[model samples]
Each structure stands twice: as structure tokens, then as C-alpha cells.
Target chain A: MLLASLQDVTFGYGDVPCLEKANIEVHSGELIAVTGPNGASKSTLLKLAMQLLHPWEGKVTLSPTNTAGNKLVVAYVPQQIAAFNSGFPSQVTEFVRSGLHTQSSNWLRRLTPQAKQAADEAMQSMGVWELRNRRIGELSGGQKQRICIARALAMSPDLFILDEPTTGMDKESRKSFYTLMREQIDRHGKTVLIVTHNLSEMNDMLDRMITLERREEGGWKCCTTTLCSGHFAPAESLH
Target chain B: MLHYDFMQRAFCAGGIIALIASALGVYLLLRRQALMADMLSHVSLAGVAAGAYLRINPSITGFIVAIIGAIAVEYVRKAYKTYSELSVAIIMVGGLSVSIILMTMNKTINKSFSSYLFGSVVAVNQLELTMMLAAALIGALFFFLLRKPLYIISFDEESARTSGIPVQWISVGFSIITGMIVAAAMPIVGVLLVSSLIILPAALSVRIAPSFTSAILVSMGIGLTGTFTGLTASYELSTPPGGTIAFILLLFLVSGLCVRKIILLASKSTSKKMRPEIAVKESRISKNGLSSNLQKIRQR
Candidate 1:
């Protein structure tokens, strides 16, 4: 059930390394959180996992589930950046519907019955089903954020990744979001890795916590803290 | 004759360009690169001027230069990621300035330039029509085939790539495709007004349509409707086809905006009137223990 791993991963921007010598393994059906301080390359690490960025000095490999023909499916919902291009003209349902576009081959097909059911259930779970007909641009910050979560849910991927999706959400909303994530992990057996700064709120829900911090010697190093204790061991030592 | 050969040819070329431009416009508008069509058109204009100066086929030169300019826009956007609109500005200015230089150097280029600027549908030669058809073919191929990738990319590029989409290649391919369309559309709407075809219809469609697909389809409808109407008006009035088409599109855009505003205003007034009553009703329902928090006002 080892889904993916980044071996000796080192990545940087313009020659200056931010994440270095990082090795991480993702097992199936685990809820994990990647926690770090500012400038700790947390987002960069997510990029590597999602294959958006390549390791300058290492390898990233995904283990093919025997049933999946060497393909490891992943769905990522990025951090809620305020500067996102809001010019997109999709209703909430339509936005979620687009998430399935990546998984299927047939382009521009009408929302199949399955896609529609998935979208409905996802929106219902995310508590945005009522907003299905509303334009995405007309929604508030938190409402739009929920729509992002709904999009990823609609994908129903084997490995789900989220980057600080609750940045602007209120306390009640954040709690519900985490509960929903927990349900996805426990009931549905979906593997999830989230990059978040809200460790105080997330520690209880996470099965494994990966800590990335600037090393004393040079580039950043990562450690894994298992269970709800919020402890850390260097990745090398853990292995 | 109700249908002259020239009229038939012009409409044939114009209709295809209209559909392509409208579809491409939705993607650009969604990406907030609404001015991309305009920038590429200007770039094509410079190429046309250069070709006319050299006494070569301007359509060929326009396509090549526009593609190059489109690629340059991608690079410039990456370089200035925080200010992506800067690329459009750079291309627009650079293209116009280059055209000015080309015009000054070859005085006879003025006549050719006017034809490009105003667009004489009657003068769309067999060769030009053939070129437009080729561009349309390429445009349609990319537009339909890449629709899914383009949708996900425009929705959230980072997320799209995270989901294993080939974002860079598709984006570059899209740029080239739009460039081809702009080059093809230049002779129909004129280089200066070509972006209007890409932008106005999309802007209008998004306002009225409920989904991205419908928005695109609506945009194409607007493009076709506007093109045929403008073509007829131009033929009757003996006006420039490019100007007539652009003017018609502007009317559509203005009307769409007005409709959206009126709808917004009307909804606001109605909601304002209903708010207090709804709150009272909600409180009464809540006391009976069957109601959700209608006490909390939803933020739009």
C-alpha cells in the first residue's frame, strides 16, 4: 500500500535550495499533515508530491496499485490565494463538474449521470449543495473555499492533497471541514496529505504529521511525527 | 442577385472565424487574458505591414508573427507572473510601434494597411479565403480536442497540473492556436477590431449563461448572430465590414452589461424588502424546532 515516495528530494527556486534531502513515503488510507513555518518550502514540497516541481537532486516515484495499471490518482486543492483569477464564469456545480474532466478521456461531454451524482454528493458533503446554482464569482471567500474542497471531493481520487484550504474559514467551518476529511479517511479509505499551518487544530485529526523546517546546517530538512502526540523524528532516523 | 459569389465567400470565411474567435475568447476571458486576442491581432498587423512592404503575402507573414508574439506573451507572463497583464501591454505597444515603422518606411503600405484596418469583405480573394479556412481547421482542432485540459487549466492552473495535466504544453499550444485564429480573423474584423470578436461575445455570454460550456456556446451564437447581422448591414450601408461587425459586437456587450446591472439592481431591491420579513418568519419557524438558522444572514 505504499502509494508514493520522494527519495532524497531537493528542490529550489533559481539555484537557492529550499527543500533538501527530504524523503517521505505515503501509504494508502492515511490522513497526514505537512506542517512548517513561513518560508519552510511547505508549498514546494506539495508541488513535488503533485509532480508540479521536479527534484533537482532526487527522484519521485509513484507505486502503481495492482488494479490501476501503474497509475496513482491524485487530486490537489491548492491554498486559497486571494489573487486567484475570478474571471472564471462557472456555477458552483459546474466548477465541481470540471474536476472530473482530468480523469476522463472524452472531452466536453455533458455531465454524465455518474458525474452529476458525484457532484451532488460532494457538494452535499461540503455543505454547498444549495449554492450549486450560484455563480462562483458571486460567492464569499469561505463559500468559494468550500467549493474548492467540493471540487476535490468530486474527483474521489485515491490520494487527495490540499494546501491550507481553510485559510479564511471561521472556527466552526474549519472544524466541520476537518471532520469531513476524517470521515473521508476512516469511512472511504482515501489517502490524504494536507499542507497547513494550523497544527493546533489539525494535530488531532492527522494520523501522521510531517514537519519541514530550516536546518541549522543549510537547506531545509523534514521529520515525521506519528499519531496525535505531535512528536517529531528526523526522516532519516524514522526510516 | 440575392446571393452573390463574393457575399457567399465573405460569409463563409467570416462565419468560421466568428465561431473560432468566440470559443477562444471564453478561454482567454476565463484566464483573465482577455486582451490576448487584441495583442496578437496587433502583432499580426505589424507582420502584415512588413509583408506588404516586402510585397509578400501578408496573411502568411501575419500568422507567423502572431504565433511568435503569442509565445513571447507566455514568456513575458512567466517573467512577470505578478503582473501578467503587462505582457499584453508590451505586445500591444511593441506591435503598433513596429507597424508604424513599417508604414513609414514603405509609403505604399498605406493602401494595404487600410484594407487590413477596415476589412473589405468583397476583396477577400480566393487565396485569402483558403488561408482563413486552414486557420479555422487548426483552430477548431485545438479548441475542441483541448477543451477539457483548457477548462481545468483556466479553473486553477496549479490544481490542473497537480492532477497530472500537461499544463505548459497545452497552454503554449493554446497560445499558438489563438494566434492562428487572430491572424485568420484580421481580414474579417480588421486587426484593430479583431479582439472585439473574441472578447465582447464571451463577456456577454458569461453574464447570461449558467455554466462554462453554455457560456462558450452562447458566445459562439452571439458571434455568428453579430457577424451575419453586421455583414448584412455593411452590405446595405456600403460601410466597412470590420467596423460594422465590431460596432454590432459592442452593442451586444453594452446590452449584456446593462442587463446584468439591471438584474443586480432589481435583485438587491427585492432582497432588501424581503430581509426583515424573512427574519421574522425564520424566528417563528425556529421556535417550533424545525428550522435552520435563517437568523444568520448569508454573505454573498
Candidate 2:
């Protein structure tokens, strides 16, 4: 099923168009990479897909049937991992447990056993379980990013969207992250969409690539691998 | 200590303020809008001054006017969404200007207004205590009911919207809660010191707790501790409780930082011992000529 679709979408910030005439479709268990230069509306497109921004033209729809009435379960990892001032006291486990916000109803009480187990599993999957009790401010950038991903995973969303998930990481860390993402896509059958500037670096892991570019005649052009390169291949054409 | 009726009222007021401030503080710290609380508190001062000029109960007038100010701030923020900070600055200036104008217009200066500006523990009466408890209970209930949506909004707004959480309403709800705390805290800590009662404990709490629950608990502990210590110290030294509470809160912030530093140092020392294993692994790879072999394969 087409999990999400953006047809002839145009988005703007108060009459200043950031994206124009863009179209895309994302299906289940696919790793789609959105790549473009700065100000090509990469982030804006992701926001539109996530329903954060309403498009000025065209329709962006999430199939409710695919979501199965679990609208609150869509996980997201933002580009910048938020920084708290020194002496921020939140533990890694606590941070991860926040992902379960959609699963339970009580706000004032503690997490349930199932919620606790999910949080633990998420931390373990992200390889940050050992640091669960440690303070978030004490973590390195890569470690913090992993914890953020773990937080998203704890939601157990069928669809996951990440904005620059591997930014500011070493090459080894990036490789490990892609491996984890691949495992989630393959093993868990989770649909993934990521917005990244470093397309050349991520080419090997992407199942398909979509580029948003400005046309000479006014308006934006969205070119996908199948339509632009005339290559209707799947993961094989990624490299 | 509890024999005096006034003291009992003061303690009750302080307890209510502690819980409300702690609850609001968690989000304020999370959103990094601690300064907004300060701005709102200062703005509410003008309302108190106006109440004093009219010879009306300042707490009631102050709360009504403060909610209006909070709504004004929200409207300004919505109007100039991109330049939200400018709205906060404008409100700060407008609030200060109003206070000065009201004070200058009234020839007979009210001592109560001055005491409120600096804060006075002796001013908390049973009526004020009852109001504080009611406000605290309502605030607690609202947060408890909307905790999930609030968490999502606090962490990331865009995702929360897509997840079906009403982002706009949540923002409004948060502002209302802020207004309530500002209102309830005024009678206990006074206008100028109210923001401190909300922010300091929450900031310190976030440093030690890993989860939101733990963070809230830590904030409550800090709030209660600060209030009790400040009250006792003020009574013993014949000093103002507001200043004492601020001083104690600052001390806790510094101590929390020191503890974090020590932990970091200890971790660094432990990681140093693990470095040799990494070095040994590298040496083994080099000895096996696997690195060069990979390089040769890549070159082809």
C-alpha cells in the first residue's frame, strides 16, 4: 500500500515559496533518501509529509487505513538533537521512555511494565542500554543521537521519518547507523524516509533517491530515480 | 513552629507554590523558556501595582491582569510567529512602563506594593493559602490528563502534529498553566521572586533525573527544600524569604554542576584504561597486513 503520497505539492512561508510542484510516494518497508542542495526545500518537504506544514497547492495524504487508527505512533528523529544547559538531570532511560507517550494515558503516574520493556528494548537495539541511568548532558554527540533514535524506536511506529539522522557522526558510526536502519527495515518491516544533504555518502544504503531542484522557468522540480535516470530498478541501482 | 496561625498559612501557601512551580518548571526548562517566566512575573508586577492603587485585593486583580498579559503575549507571539522573542521583549518593556506610570500617578505610596515587589513571608493569609491550594490542584489535574500530548509537543512540535496531538491547543494550554503558576506564586513568593520559585527547582531537577517523572520528583524535592530552608533562615535572621529562597536555589544549581563534573572526570579516567585495548586491536590489524590488503582491493 502507498503509505504516504504528496501530489503536486507546493509549500510556502507567507507567499515565499519553499517548494513547488513536488510529488512523491512512499511505501512500506522502503528506505527512501531525499537529497538536495541547501534551500532546495528538503526539510520543508519532510515537514509537509509529516503534516507539520500545510501545502499551499496540491494534496499530501497519509492513508488512515495503513496507520490503522494509530495516528500517534509515527516516530520521528529531528535533525538537531536538542541541547539542555549544563546540569540537565534527565537520564538516558527517562529520555527514551518519553517515546511511550502515545502508548499510555496517565500523565502524572509512572510507566507501565510493557512500556518499560519497550523502552529497554529500544535502548538495547540502539546499543545505549548500558547508559540508560546516565545523565543525557554527559553523552557525546553521536551517543546522544543514538539515544534520540532509541526514543523514536520506543514508539514502535510503522513509519519512521528522520531528518539528517547521521549528521556530525564519524564514518564508522554512520556505517553502524545504516546497518541498524537496514535491520529495522528488513526485520521489523518499518517504512523509513530520511532527509540528508550527504547523498554520495548514503548512496549505498538508499533503496531509491529523490531530488528536489529548481527549474529555470520558475517552480521546483522533483526528480526520482525511475523518472529522472530512466532506471526503474530497485535497491540494485542505489550504488 | 506550627503554633502560629499565620505560620501555618504561610507553610500551606509555600507547599502549594512548591508543587505548582515544580510542575510548571519541568516544561519551562524543557522548552528553554525559563526567561519567559521571569518576563511574565515582572509584567504581573504592574497589575499588582494597579491593584494597590485601587485599594483592591492585589492577588485577585494581579491574577486577572496577569492572565490578560499572558494572553497578550500569546497573541503577540502568534502575530509575529517568526519573531516571537521580540514579543517577549515588548511585553517586558510595556509591563515595566505600566508599573512606573502607576506608581508615579499615585501620590500616597502603598507599602504593600513595595513589599510585594521584594516579597514578604508575613503577607500570606489564609485566603491566599486557600487560593494557592486550589490553583495547584487544578494545574496538577490538567497536566496529569494531558501528559502524553504535552510530552510529544515539548520534544518535537512537528512530529506531534503529525501524530494527531493538537499542537496549537497544547501550546495554549501550556501558556494557561504558566499564567496560573504566575498568579498562584505571587501571594507566596511575591511578583519579582515568583519566576525563581518556578524555574530554579525544575532546572536543577532535570540535571539529576533521567525521565520526566524523575525530573518532576526532583523538582518537587528542590522546591520544598528551598522553601523550608528559606523560610527558616528568613525567620532566624529577620531577612526576606524571597532573597533567601533565591540564594538557596542558586546554591543547589552550583552543587549539581559540581557533581556532574566529578562524574565526568571519573568516566574519563575509566575510558583511558580502555584505550589500550583499541590500540592493541589496531596493532593486530596492521600486523596481519589486512589494512593494506583492503586498501589494495579498494584501489582496484
Q: Chain A TM-score per candidate?
A: 0.88, 0.84
- Residue A124, model 2, lDDT: 93
Top candidate (lDDT): 1
Each candidate's DockQ score against the native complex?
0.55, 0.38
Docking class of 2: acceptable
lDDT tens digits, residue span A1-239, model 2 = 68888998877877777777778998887888887777777788888887777888999987664545444257778776544223445678877887777544545567889889989998997889889888877787778888888988888888888988876677877777777776788898788888876655554566767777667686655545343243124433443
Show the colliding residue pairs in model 2. A88-B206, A88-B207, A89-B206, A89-B207, A89-B208, A90-B209, A90-B210, A91-B209, A91-B210, A94-B211
Model 2 misplaced stretches (Cα beyond 4 Å): A67-72, A82-88, A103-115, A169-189, A197-207, A218-239, B52-56, B78-83, B255-300
RMSD of each: 6.1, 5.3
lDDT of 2 at A25: 93
lDDT of 1 by residue, B209-268 (tens): 877889999999999999988999899998888999999999988988998899999999
lDDT of 1 by residue, A43-62 (tens): 88888876777789999977
lDDT of 2 by residue, B184-241 (tens): 7876667778888888898777766776777888899999888888877777897887
Q: Distance (Å) between predicted and true CA of B132, model 2?
A: 0.9
Question: Model 1 off-target regions past 4 Å?
Answer: A6-17, A20-23, A55-69, A81-87, A108-112, A214-239, B1-5, B89-105, B276-300
TM match of model 2 to true structure: 0.83
